[model samples]
Target: MSIEQRVTEEMKVAMRAKDKVRLIALKGIRAAFIEALKEDGSESLADDRATTILRRLAKQRRESIEAYEQGSRADLAALERAELEVIDAFLPSLADEETTRAWVEEAIASTGASSPGDMGRVMGALMSAHRGDLDGKLANRLVRELLGS
Candidate 1:
C-alpha cells in the first residue's frame, strides 16, 4: 500500500492500542498531508511527496529535541524524540552507506564538482538521482568530505 494509506492504517492501530504518542504524531502527519493537498490543489499525494513531508516533520522534531535539550528541558526533548520515532516509521529507509557513497561519487563526477563551490550542483544531482530514498543531510556531509570542504 501507499505511504498515505499505511499511515492511516497505522493511525487506527495506534488509536486502538491507545498509543498516545504515535496517535498524536499520526494526526499531525494527516493534518500535514491534508494541508499540502489543499495548498497544491492536488487530489492525491505521491509516495515521494508523503515521504518528503515526513522527513520534514522528522527534521522539525529533531530540531525541537536539540533546542529543548539545550534549554535543559529533558521532558520536552523526550516528547520530541517519541514523536520523531513515530514520524520516522512512515519515511522510506535511506540508502545503505555503500550505495550512498557510490551515488555521491557519481554525483560529483556527473556534476564536475571538484570543489565546495560546486556543492549545490552535486547536491541537486544527488537528490534528483535518489529522490525520496536519500538522506539529504548525510549526502551533504558526504559531499563536503569528498570535496575536501
Candidate 2:
C-alpha cells in the first residue's frame, strides 16, 4: 500500500488502541502531506514525494529534539523523540555504512568524480539514483572522504 494508505490504517489502529503518540504523529504526517500537495498543486503525491515529506518531518523532529535537549527541556525532547520514532516507522531505512560506501564508490565512478571539485556531480547522481531513500548528508560526507576532500 501507499504510505498515505498505510498511515491511514495506522491512524485507525492507533485510535482504536487509544495510542495518543501514534495518533498525533499520523495526524502530523497527514498535515504535512496536505501542505505539500497545496504548495505543489498536485492532485496526489507520488510515492517518492510522500516519502520525502516523511523524511522532512523526521528531520524536523530530530532537530527539535536536539534543540530541546540543548535548552534543557527533557519533556519537550521526549515528545519530539516519540514523534520522530513514529515518523521513522514510515521512512525507508537508510543504507548502512557499507552499502552507503558502495554507493559513494559507484557515484564517484559514474560521475568520474576524482576530486572534491566534482562533489556536485557525484551528489546529483547519487541523489537521483536513490531519491527519497538516500541520505544526502551522509552521502556527501562519504563522497568527500573518498575524494580526499
lDDT of 1 at 98: 81
What's the lDDT for candidate 1?
0.90
What TM-score number comes out for model 2? 0.92
Task: Give per-model TM-scores.
Answer: 0.91, 0.92
**Which predicted model would earn the best lDDT?**
1
Instruction: Report lDDT (CA) for all predictions.
Output: 0.90, 0.89
Q: Evaluate residue 77 in candidate 1 and report its C-alpha lDDT on the 0 to 100 scale.
A: 97
The residue-level lDDT of candidate 2 at 53 comes to 89
In terms of TM-score, the best-performing candidate is 2
Off by over 4 Å in 2: none
Q: Write the per-residue lDDT of candidate 1 for residues 5-117, one digit (tens) a residue.
A: 98899999999999998899899999999999999999988887898899999989999999999999999999899999888888778898788999999999988889899
Error at 83, model 1, angstroms: 1.0
Residue pairs that clash (backbone atoms under 3 angstroms), model 2: none
What lDDT does model 2 reach?
A: 0.89
lDDT value, residue 148 of candidate 1: 95
